[model samples]
Target: MTKTALSHKSASPWLEDMRRRFRTLPFLKATGNTVFLFIFFYLYLYIQRNPVFEVTQIPATQLDRWIGFQPWALALYLSLWVYTTLPVALQPDLKQLTKYGLHIGLMCALSLLIFVFWPTSVSAAVGPREGGGMFAMMYAVDTNGNALPSLHVAAAVFSFMWLQTIFRSVRAPIWLRVVDALWCAGICYSTLAVKQHLLLDVIAGGALGAVAGWLSLRSAGRGKIAG
Candidate 1:
């Protein structure tokens, strides 16, 4: 067989296996994601509206200034909600699905706690004018508080880690893995490009996400998803 033909043959089984998993308990997975996300947003909005501590503005770094505001990045920034659902939706069984939830939930809980205690906000001058359009709506609803350890970046990173593990376990193609990485990177960059978060916030959020994802994978006693 030609090398290209051999490669395709080798890849077919894993691709078929992934398709079977996606067909398992589809309704339950969708409901779980919807309910958990609703709860998360409720808590997040409540904390944003009522901070326990005095709100502090996050100071911008030179890096923050260097990355100019890009209005187009709002698409990537908002895409985090959809991106996060992928990991949970792909879980092949209830056990793995629950574990994913607990780990991600804990990470989010920690970030919310920090938001309540520290209560940080980004300066209004950093981003686009909130006079009208989607930016105005986002600014109106998601007002700057909960700035440090941005849950947005943290969630994106956490999802990326889980997706990476799942993809590796299924022996997914290299191109699929590249798309996953690029999507995650775009979400991270969007947080800054949209001026919703400062450099320190993104750094801290990335660290928090990496640590949580690493610990979750380690404690699960395996690096890849259950086959």
Candidate 2:
């Protein structure tokens, strides 16, 4: 009985120490960026839901259709970035939150502009015949509005190229960077597997994300975080 009591006492100190460490790192900052991100996400849904934003389906041409194949197909992949970035945003006062919000805002602004000016949609329509593929859950993703500048590919490309600097200061080793890279790569690939976006959209998204990520890292400061 005494041995059991002693073991409990011994671990209590370590557990308490861990608790203290965790308490230092909060989970959410709830800053302007947080509010803005929520607002923007809502606005995205609103734009899609509104009848004002019509879904314009594209006609299939031979060259454009062939984008479905390999070599070219590789560029279309983008799932991991979609899933992972939000989780990162959940972390507390990382400063990167604001940076991310800014980049995301730029994407949204660019997309919104495209939506307004070009006002186009994908040629492919996911209807009753549309398969229950990776994006099956998001089947509502019809060819109505929201087509130009694929946010998925853009975000992944943005994160991959930009966050490398941030991760370098992350205090992790080479293996961790490699793992993170794979995760980023997966995010890029997942976009296509899910079929939520097409090749043209992905390419545009990549460009936007890349530019945004670059600007974000630059604004985030010279790779040196205080405290």
Candidate 3:
């Protein structure tokens, strides 16, 4: 057989396996994750609008100024919703999906609790730009509260960790992993680029995500989900 034919034959099983894995529990996973998103957003917006304590302002760093505002990065910032759902959609079974949800849900709960007691916001001087469009609508709805430990960055990193594990388990290509990393990085960067979060918020959010992802994977036996 030719080398091309041999390579194709070798790659077929993992590709088929990945397809089968993704096909598992599709409807159930989508519905459950969607419902969780709605609940999370409702709680988040409620907390944002009604902070019990004085909202601490997060200071921008030189990095923030260097990155500056990029109106185009809004697409990357908003892509976080779709990015976060990929792992849940690709879970191989109900047990694993449930476990993933629980871990992420707990992380969000902790963040929400922190929001309640120690609310934070972006510096007014560097807030989202003024103008009518998606940015205006986003700013109107999201406001400046819940700034520290950006849930946007946290969710992106959490999804990144889960996706890397999933891809490794399926023997996905190295390029696929690189794309995953780039996507996660873009989402994290967008938080700052759009002036939605400061440098400190991104750092804290990344830390929160790493800790939660590590704990979740550890509990899942290093991402080995039994059939």
Candidate 4:
């Protein structure tokens, strides 16, 4: 009986640490959210490409015209996937992970709903992806639909906001924040530069992302207070 009691006492700290680590696991939640959003995004693309929907081409504004076409921006545009995946490492707690996933899920849902009901396409001429290179591959997979509210921009904005919060929580350096901010801004501009979205689409996407980010943060705060 004395030996058993001593063994249990020695194991208690290990058990408690395991529990803490389990609660803080962010990769599973982030991966789950990523898969779900991608499937839904594919569905949105299908709906947009369907011939049954009345696809209205959104005309570019004067601002859109001013935003020159820069094919090199494709690198920055594709970097959004990497930017979004950073949360798996940066999220320090279950609360932060929850908020990040919720923000992305909500952002995708709202953007998809708009795409389904009010389908829009880009009117501006995007240079042909004819070389069968990286850009061609991207164009092949990424259908030209869901144009009004750029999900790319929305995702970038939502991701950066959550990342900012996470950085604050971890007391990350100011340089990290600056780099993140610059990256996010580059992603936003890349959308326009690549001709994937117009100026208005970017504006609306940014607004939606901001609202969703704000809501997610508010919800997380309330949860903390209630707890």
Q: Give a tens-digit lDDT track for model 1, residues 112-222.
A: 888888899887446554436998899888877788998888888888988888888888888999999999999999999988899888999999999999998887645
Candidates sorted by lDDT, descending order? Answer: 3, 1, 4, 2
Global lDDT of each candidate: 0.85, 0.54, 0.87, 0.74
Cα lDDT tens digits, model 3, 158-192, are 99998888888877789989999999999999988
All predictions: root-mean-square deviation over Cα? 3.8, 6.9, 3.2, 6.9
Residue clash pairs of candidate 4? none
For TM-score, the strongest prediction is 3
* Candidate 1, superposed: residue stretches over 4 Å from native: 1-11, 124-131
The CA lDDT at 8 in model 2 is 70
TM-score of each: 0.91, 0.64, 0.92, 0.79
TM-score quality measure for candidate 1: 0.91
lDDT of 2: 0.54
Candidate 4: which stretches are off by over 4 Å?
Answer: 1-27, 123-132, 222-227
TM-score of 4: 0.79
Model 3 regions lying over 4 Å from their true place: 1-11, 125-128
Give RMSD (Å) of candidate 3 vs. truth.
3.2
Query: Candidate 3 overall Cα lDDT vs. reference?
Result: 0.87
